[model samples]
Target: MTMPGRTRTKVCGLTNADDVAAAVDAGADALGFIVDVPVDTPREISPERAATLVGAVPPFVSTVLVTMAPIESIPALHERVGTDAVQVHGDVDVGAIDRLAGDCDAALVKTVDAAKPESARAYADAADALLVDSTDESGAGGTGRTHDWTATHDLAASLDVPVILAGGLTPANVAEAVGAVDPYAVDVASGVESEGGVKDHDAVRAFVSNAAGASADGAEVSA
Candidate 1:
C-alpha cells in the first residue's frame, strides 16, 4: 500500500463495526476508537468492542485507542485491546507518557490542546507522535472547534516526531491545512459526523478524497 504524502487521514470516534468498515472503505489510513468513558462522543467503545473492531482492520491499516489522563491502566488496556497506537489526552505528565509507551509496548501519541504548545512539546521526547487538538471543557475529544493551525504548524516543524493534526478539520479546509502544516496525519471526528459518533459515509469519502488530493499536490511541490 502506498503511504499518502502530506496528510494521511485518520477517521476518529468510530463505534460500530459497520462504521469501522466504512471508514476503511472510505480510504482512512487509520481508525480511532475512543476509550475515554462518560463522554458525549459516539466513538467510545468498550475494550471487548474495540478488540472486535481492531480485528476487522486489514494489515497496514492502524487502529488507535484514545485515552484520558492518569494513564495508570494503559499497560493492561494495551495488552488486552492490541491496538497499534495509544493516544493519551487530558492532564498527563511526560513521565507517564514515557512509562506507558515503554511498559505497554504500544506506539504512543501525546495529545495537547492547540492553546498549549509548550505542554505539547514537553512530551515530544516521550511520544512517537503529537496530536494537536482543540481545548474542550468536557475533557473529551471530537469537539468541532478549531485551534490555531499556525501555531500547530510551527510546533510540527520543531518536533522530530510525526504530528497528527486534529480539531475542526473538514473536507473543505483539509487541503489548506495540508498546505500549511504538512502533518504526518490528519484526524477528524465531529467534522465528518452526521450526529456525534455516527459517521456519514459520503462525508468520510469526501474527506479522504480531499486529503489525498492535498497530499498529491504537496508531493508534487516537494518533488
Candidate 2:
C-alpha cells in the first residue's frame, strides 16, 4: 500500500469542547481525548465526556480515544466515545488486541516507548498503526520531553505500518522532528497546551504549519 505523502498532525489531550474546537480550528487532522487512563493526568476524562466531545467533532476530522485501560475495557470505552481511532498506551495484550480488533471498528494504534523501539515489533503486525512516544515516571505519555530521534527514525523506516511520532513536540521543534523521522504523522499534547487541559491555539497552528512545511521540504529534497 502507498503511504500518505503529507505528514499529518494530531493535537491530543484536549479536555473540553472549546479546546477541541480550537485544535480543529488550528487545522489538526486528528484530536485525541484521554479517557479513564490508569495514570493520573488532568487530561484524563470520563468516557461519557470523551463521547460528548468526540460526537461534537465535525466530519472529515478524526477523533481518537487515548487510553491505558485494560484490553477488555477498550470495547466499552471505544463504544462510548465512538472515536474514529484508539491510541493504546502502556503494557498492552497482543492477543487481546487481536480480539479487540474483531470487537470494535475503530482503528487500533499501539504506542511504544521510544526507549524500547524493539517492543514495537510485537504490535507492528497487530495494530493498524504504531505511535512512538516518550515515556516518563508519570505514564506512557504526557511527558513534556523529547526522546532519541535517531531511534525513532530507524524504527519508522523498518516498520511496515504507518508510524506516528509523539512526545515533547512543540511548534518550535516539530518541524525538526518531522524532518528527522519523516513519520506518517506527529502527535502532541502537553506541547501545545497553555496549562494542563487548555490549548494554546497559536501554538497549535504553528505546530500544524511547521509539520506541513517539513513535509514540503522532504518532497522538495526527494524531487
Candidate 3:
C-alpha cells in the first residue's frame, strides 16, 4: 500500500522489452502487460511473450497482467505470466473476483468505471486495490480521457482498498490529477505512449517525476 501521503505510479500497456525497461527506469511502481484482452488493442501480447518480459522485471518493480474482466481464464494467464498483479477492466462480478484472488498468487486490481461509482466499494472486499478509469464506448478502460476527479476523490475516501486513478493521465496534467484525487497511485497507458504499444521514454520519465512530486498531502512519494 502507498504510505500516508505518497502516490505510486503504474505504466500500462507494455508490449516489448524496451517499453518495460523504459517504465522501470522511469521509476514506475508497477508495469502492466496487456495479455489476451477480449477486445482489439495494438498493445495485446501473447502470454508467452508476457512471461518473458515479466521474468525480466527487476525486484520490487511489480509486473501486472492486464486483461478484460472474466474470472474463468485469469488464473491460467496469471500463472503463465508470473506477474505480481492482475488488473481487470470491465463489469466485474464480486464473487468471481474473490475467487480469482484466492486462486492466484498475484494480487487483484479491479477497475471501476467512474460512470458507475456504486460498484467500487464492493470490489474492496475482494480486490487488493481498486482502479478508477474513464471507460470507452464499449464500457472498457483505456479511453485516454479524463473523468471527474472530484467524484474519484470521493470514491477513494469511501473505499477500504487503495485506489489507483487512471484514464487520460499525461505528464502535463498528472500533478493536477494527483492534487484533485489524492489517489494511492496513478496509472497511464496512452498518456505515456508515443503510439499504441510503444513507450515514449521522455514522456514516461516526465510522468514519473511529476507524479512523484505531486502528492496533495505535501509529502514525498513512498519508497
Candidate 4:
C-alpha cells in the first residue's frame, strides 16, 4: 500500500456521543468504540450504546468497533451499530478475520502486539490494515507505554497492507514517529487521554496537528 501523505488519525476507546463528537471535531479520520465484553477498559461500551454513539457521527467519519471476540459476534454488532469498520485485537486466526471480512462487510483492522512481528505478518495478509500495538497479555490495549518503533518500522516496511502505528503515541513524538516509520495512519488511546479511556481534547488536537505537519514535510520531500 502507498504511504498516505496525510497521516490519518484514529481516536480509540470512545464510549459516549460527546467523546465521539470531540474526536470528530479534532479532525479524526476514524473513531473507535471498544465493544469488548468482560470489559477490559473503562471506556468499554455496550452494543446499544455503541450504536447510539455511531449514530451521532456524521457521514464521511468512520465508526470502528474494536473487539477481542470471535468473528461470530461481528454480524450482530455490525447490524446494530452500523460500523464502517471492525478492529480485531486478539489472537484471532486469519481465517476468522477473512470470515469477518466477508460477514461484516466492513474494513478489517487486525492488531498485533509489537512483540510478535511474525504473528503480525500472518494476520496482515487477511486484514485491510495492521495495527502494531504494545503487549498486554490480558487482551486490553492502551497501556500508555511505547513499544519498539524500530520493530514496528521493519514490520511496516515488509507488509503490503496499510500499517497503522499504535501503542502509546503522543503529540510530542508523533512527528518523530511519522518521520521514522511512515505509517499509513496513527492510532491512539491512552496517549491522548487524561486517564485510561478518557480522551484529553487538547492532546488529541495537538497529536493530529503534529502528524499533519509531519505529513506535509514528508510530502514536500517526496515532491
Candidate 5:
C-alpha cells in the first residue's frame, strides 16, 4: 500500500522491453500493459509479449496487465501474462470482479468510468484499488481526455481503497490533477507516449517529478 500524502505513478501502454525500462528509470511505480483489447487500439499486446516484458520488471515496480476480456477467460490470461496485477476496464460488473478475485492471484485494479461516482464504493470493496478514467466511445479508457476532478476528489475522499486517477493526464497537468483530486496514484498512457505504445522518456521523468512535487507542496489546483 502507498503511504499517505505520497502519490504513486503508473505509466501504461508499455509494449517493449525498452519502454518498460524507460518507465522504470523515469521513476514509474507501476507499469501497465494493454492485453486483449479492441482490435483498433494500438496499445494492445499479446500475452506472450506481455509475459516477457513483465519478467523484466524489477521488484517494487509493479507489472499490471490491463484487460477487457471476459471473467471466464481471466485465469488463462493471468497465467499467460504473468503480471503482478490486472486492471479490468470497459463495462464490467462487480460480480465479474468478485469472480476474478477468486480465480486470480494477482491484485485487481478496477477502472470505473469517470461519470459513475455512485458505483465507486461498491467497486472499491471488490478490488484492491479503483482507477477513475475518461472512457472513450467504446466505453474503454485511453481516450486522452480529462474528466471532472471535483467528482473524482469527492469519490477518492469517500473510499477507503486507493483511487488512481487516469485519463488524459500529462506532465503539464499532472500537478494540477494531483492537487485537485489528491489521488493515491495517477496513471498515464497517451500522456507519456510519443505514439500509441512508444513512450517518451523525458515526458515520463517530468510527469513523475511533477506528481511528487505537487503532492509535497499540497497546493490546491483550480477546477
Candidate 6:
C-alpha cells in the first residue's frame, strides 16, 4: 500500500467500529481512544469498549489510549484496554511518565499543554512522542483550538523524538499548520467530525490527503 511521505496522522476521539474502520481505511497511521478521564468529552469510552475497538483494528494502525488515570492504574488499564500506546495527560508529572514507562509495555505519549510550553522541554526525552495541545480552563485536551505554532516550531526543532501537533486542526488549515510547525505527525478530533464524536468521512479523506501532500513537500525541500 502506498503511504504518505513521512508525516503521520492520528484520528482521535473515535467511538464506534464504523469510525475506526473509516479512519484506518482513510489512511490514519494511528487511532486514539479516550479512557479513564475525569472531564466529560463526548468521545470518552470505557476500557472494555476501548478493548473491543482495539481488537477490531487491523495490523499497522496503532491504538492509543488517551487516559488521565493515576500512575498506579496504568498497567491494569493497558491490560484491560489492550492499547498499543497510552497518552498521559491531566496533571501529569515527570515521575508519572517514568512510572508509566517502567510499568507498561505499550508506547508512552506525553501531552504538553500550550499553557505550559516549558513543560514540553522537560518531557521531551521521557516519552516515545509528545502531543502538543491547547489548554482550556479544565486542563483537559481535545480543545479544538490552536496554539502558537511558532512555539511548537521551536519545540519540535529541539526535541529528540517526534512531535504530534493537535488542537483546532481541520482540512482547511492543517497544511498551514504543517508549514508552520513542521510536526512529525498531526492529530485531529473535532476538525474532521461531522458532529460530536462522529467523524465526517469526506473530511477525513481531505485531511489525510492534505497532510500527506504537505509532508511530501517538506521532504522534497529538505532533500
User: Residue by residue across 1-223, what tens digits does model 2's lDDT show?
Assistant: 1156778999999899888888888889999999877777899888888889988999999999998887888888898889999988878777878888998899999888888877788888899999888887544787887998877888888888998999899998988888788899999998988888888888989998888777524432232
lDDT by residue (tens digit), candidate 1, 24-132: 9998999998875555555677888888889999999998888773588887887777889998878777887777777887789888888878987798899988888
Clashes (backbone N, CA, C under 3 Å), per candidate, total: 1, 0, 0, 0, 0, 0
Off by over 4 Å in 3: 1-3, 217-223
| Candidate order, lDDT descending | 3, 5, 6, 2, 4, 1
* Residue 132 CA displacement from its true place in model 1, Å: 0.3
Candidate 4: residue 83 Cα off by (Å): 0.8
lDDT of 5 by residue, 1-223 (tens): 2338668899999888988988888888999999997647788889999999999899999989999887789878999988889999877778888988999999999998888787777787899999999987666899899999888988888888989999889999999998888899999999988887788899999998888778524673232
Rate residue 196 of model 5 by lDDT.
75
lDDT at residue 25 of model 3 (Cα atoms): 91
Which one wins by TM-score: 1 or 6?
6
* Per-residue C-alpha lDDT of model 4 across residues 1-223, encoded as one tens digit per residue: 4485678889888876667778888899999988855545787888888898898899999989888765698778778878999888767778888887888878988888888889888987799998888858765567777888777878888889999888878998888887777889988887888876678889989987777677523432332
Q: TM-score per candidate, in order?
A: 0.91, 0.93, 0.94, 0.92, 0.94, 0.93
Residue 143, model 5, lDDT: 87
**Model 1 worst lDDT run, 10 consecutive residues:** 214-223
What lDDT is reached at residue 191 by model 6? 94
Candidate 5, after superposition: displacement of residue 33 in Å?
0.5
* Candidate 2: worst-modelled 10 consecutive residues by lDDT: 214-223
Off by over 4 Å in 2: 137-139, 216-223
RMSD of 3: 2.1
List where candidate 6 sits over 4 angstroms from the true fold.
1-5, 216-223
Count backbone clashes in candidate 2.
0
